[model samples]
Target chain A: MSTGDFIFTGLGHAYLKDNWIFRNYRGEAVRGQVLALLGPNGSGKTTLLKILLGALTPSEGSVNIQGQVAFVPQLFQVAFDYTALDMVLMGRAKKVGLFSQPTPADEEAAINALERMGIGHMAYRPFHEMSGGQRQLVIFARALVAEADILILDEPTSALDLKNQNGILEWIDRLARRENLTVIFSTHHPHHAYAVADQALLMLGENDFESGPVGDVLTEKNLLQLYGLPLKRLTFDYEDLNVETLVPVFRNCKRRKAN
Target chain B: MTEKTVKQEKFSACSSGRFRRWLPKTPLARPWILGLILLIAIIGSLFMGAYPIPWHRILEILLNSVWPFSGSESAYLDLREITVVTLIRPPRILVAVLAGIALGMSGTALQGMMRNPLVGPDLVGVTSGAAFGAVLAMWLGFLYTPVILVLSTIGGIAAMLGTMALARVVGGRNDSLPLILAGFFIGAFFLAGVGLLIYLENPFYPKGQRTGNIIYWLLGTFRGAGPVKAWTIAVPTIVGGTVLMGLRWRLNLLSLGDLDASSLGINLNRLRWILITVVSLMVAGQVAVSGVVGWVGLIIPHAARMLVGPDHRRLIPASAMLGGLFVLGLDNFTRTVIWSEVPVGVLSAIFGTPLICFLFWKTKTKGWNE
Candidate 1:
């Protein structure tokens, strides 16, 4: 099934008595595509994602989802220790009966997902003992084992080093293409979105947002307006390799005065 | 090249493969072993009272009771011995087993639901609330068993609801810190109320009478066990335990926190309310009969987890059986070893504290997650 078909009309949310965070937001994500939601802090990106995951009810408007959606949270803090395999097996909750335990087949699927992520060896390791990036990969494997066609990730690469960030983004791109899964992930890095995302959603403010093909919605003018900062798009080509970069000008900020 | 080398190294370093070989192939094996142990403990406990019955007679009586059709009524068996062995001992042992099962299952559910290992009936004020209710019933001269049962059930449910509501109001939905704080406050409030009741009753009753009642409420005992009391604790414990066991897999999901559980297609509000209701019933039933038994709930599940990992499927049944064994063993020790009959609650703490400390130390060294 092409599970990424989602349409939101006039989506809005307001918290704490009439203070609107985002209102009248409209967007659509096609099947088998990756939509990158870009915004700075306090831009309601997380709220929008929650609304899509159906964890939060939109104050106005409706959202239509074509298939099951699995959510990969940014981080998980467990009070008790669970193994990485145990964590991944939790994804089979929807498939198993409420009273029934996970079957051997389910265990096989969890192990397969971990192997797919190149972390099968960590299956029995305690999740809390693993490094942040490794835990993030386990979370990804958990989402994969859910068998959902639509994967929603909340800032999947926010707190990772360079190699780990690239690894996660590369996995997302490859998974979307190989399995025809639809993915929506939020990120602070615009370059990462440019590298992998097929579409972009830019949240400018409480009432203003933009969504379209990545090439159209992620232009220098749109990002500059989104962050209210000067940025430049640079491209270079050499020996059949092309590189694109979005660099901040960093000239507009004034030096801080001594307190 | 480094990534490939690291992958190779990790493949060889997978310790779970070694661990899996030591674990039972089926989940039911450990629980069955524990059940056998409990059965042996029960039979052994029957031989321990002031009127000592021989083991051979105890065995013959048990066998004849189960197989009445078999023509093997021993002519040598004394009527008094039969009465003590069959009639007197079974009810008390059944009560202890049922109470242990209730506390262990409830503790597993609450700890999983709250996602805190330290949480128990006492931590959540359920025991204290029930204690207050039972103590108040005694103070009011309503010494009827049914009256105390009803009042304690209501009190336990009320305290849990109050704690949950306080947690919600103070810190959004089911935040752990606020819930624990609310439990501590509510528990303390009810415990003080119990103390006040004891003080008020001191003048009307003699000092010994008042003190004994208060001690019974604080340190649980099974001396009051009879057929009626056994059924009172057994029926609810069986029903509630079956329900909790049925939802064991879901309980595993609940430990992941609310949002993750919901995202996985669990109805969080519905499941939470069901858990709270069943857990309250189990705790109230046990508390009404045995007074506020502490630490059996807390320590047994932790021990079970050490044996059976954190999967609720194995953990729940293992906990229940181990709890039965632990309480039965302790009660046997209380009746047989000590000249004075010490309350099981007091003995549990005396023994449970050091074991819990050891468990904590072991968990810290081995890593709880491992």
Candidate 2:
């Protein structure tokens, strides 16, 4: 099956009655590609994500989504002790009838998704009792079980440790390539985007944004302008491996004199 | 394929050992057990009453009433005994069961929708609003049962809408604290209205009639439940309960919060309103028949959640049956244990409060942290 794509033309959104948060934003996320959205705090990344998910109607412009989309939020708080499998099974809500329970086929799909995410052992564990990273993995499993053409995640790796962050990023990349799924995710780290993203959409502000391949859009200059902080790129070569890392340069230091 | 088989084996291996011994093997078994207990409770209730009737005689009266040709040799079955069994006792017990189911299902729905275990019809002002409407009907001399049912149903919907509006005004959408706070004020407001109606009793009527109606409205009892009242409560409860049960899976998604639910193809606002209306109707039906019975809606759903996990498909039915059993048992206690009949509401609170407290203590350490 061919993957699906989302094309947005002149998209805009406003909070409250008419106060515009972002306007005239345009981008296209192609099928079988990972689009990384980068923005500072209060930069309307979530609002843009909401517009794509059809949770909010944009005031100006239109978006064409090719197929069904699933979202994995940053965190999920379950007030009751639903097992991890039960939580993943909810992804089949669109497929299940209104009054019907999840069938064995659905359960098998959920279990397969969890196993794909390498969390099959956690299927019977209570979702609320699992650690934060494990819970996030289960949520990813939910999105995988949905089998949506487009997967949208809002800061999926923000709360995770370094290892978990890499694990989730690797899964996103693998899912995009192997399953031919369209993936759009927002993150605070530019290096993460560089590591796995095929394309980048940088939200500068209303009427000012950048969207292109990761190689062109995630430069040191663009990264510096995005967060207004000095950054230095360092390359390490050990044996047959070469790694490039971005480090923030702290230039100004003024020691307080003791009274 | 190899990995898939290994994973499948691990899945069953993980599930098989962790299944609790106390819990039933499947979701279906728990409901059957609850149904059996409810049947036992109903029969036991039939046996223990002010009038001491033998179990065999009760069965004979029930069968003879159902089929006239099934005649017993004993002609000593008095009309009083037959009437008491067929007419008086059954209706009251049925009313209790219906009210319990309504309250229990509504509680489960509201708690799931709100994503808070502590919420119920009474806490959210639906019961109080219905109580006020019933009391108003009584004071206005419009004491017809259907009138009370309609007015109370409207009152409950109004109260629920008012709470939503107030929550919007106080905090942004999808804020639980503001909704609970709004419910608190609305409950107090309707309660005050009920109290005012009690204060302004009609002098043309006997003092006992006015005071007695007020007592029934404030502290719920199934005392005067007849076949008409029982059936009146049954229709709405059945309809509303069915709708709630059908929306059980949706409720599970809703408890995941608005953003997550919307992403899963659920129309969050529409689902929320439908749930609120269904819950209001159930609460109103129960309040119309039995005045503002507390704690059944709150405690029974929690108990059911503990028995069966948070899957609402199982939770809703379990809660409804357990609710029926709970109120039926309590009503029996009220009728048989005391020299004078005590309000079932008072008894429910006496039992429900400690259980809720224990649940609060139990679930406090888990579940709340994000």
Most accurate candidate by TM-score: 2
Per-model lDDT = 0.83, 0.84
lDDT of 2 at B282: 84
Fnat score for model 1: 0.52
Give lDDT tens digits, candidate 1, residues A5-57: 98888988997657888888887777888999999999898899999999999
Model 2, range A176-231, lDDT digits (tens) per residue?
99878899999998888887888999898777888899878887788788889876
Residue B106's lDDT within candidate 2 is 94
Task: State residue B329's C-alpha deviation in candidate 2, in Å.
Answer: 1.2
Per-model DockQ? 0.45, 0.45
Which TM-score values does chain B get in all models? 0.87, 0.90
Alpha-carbon runs more than 4 Å astray in model 1: A252-259, B1-29, B63-73, B136-147, B172-176, B199-218, B366-370
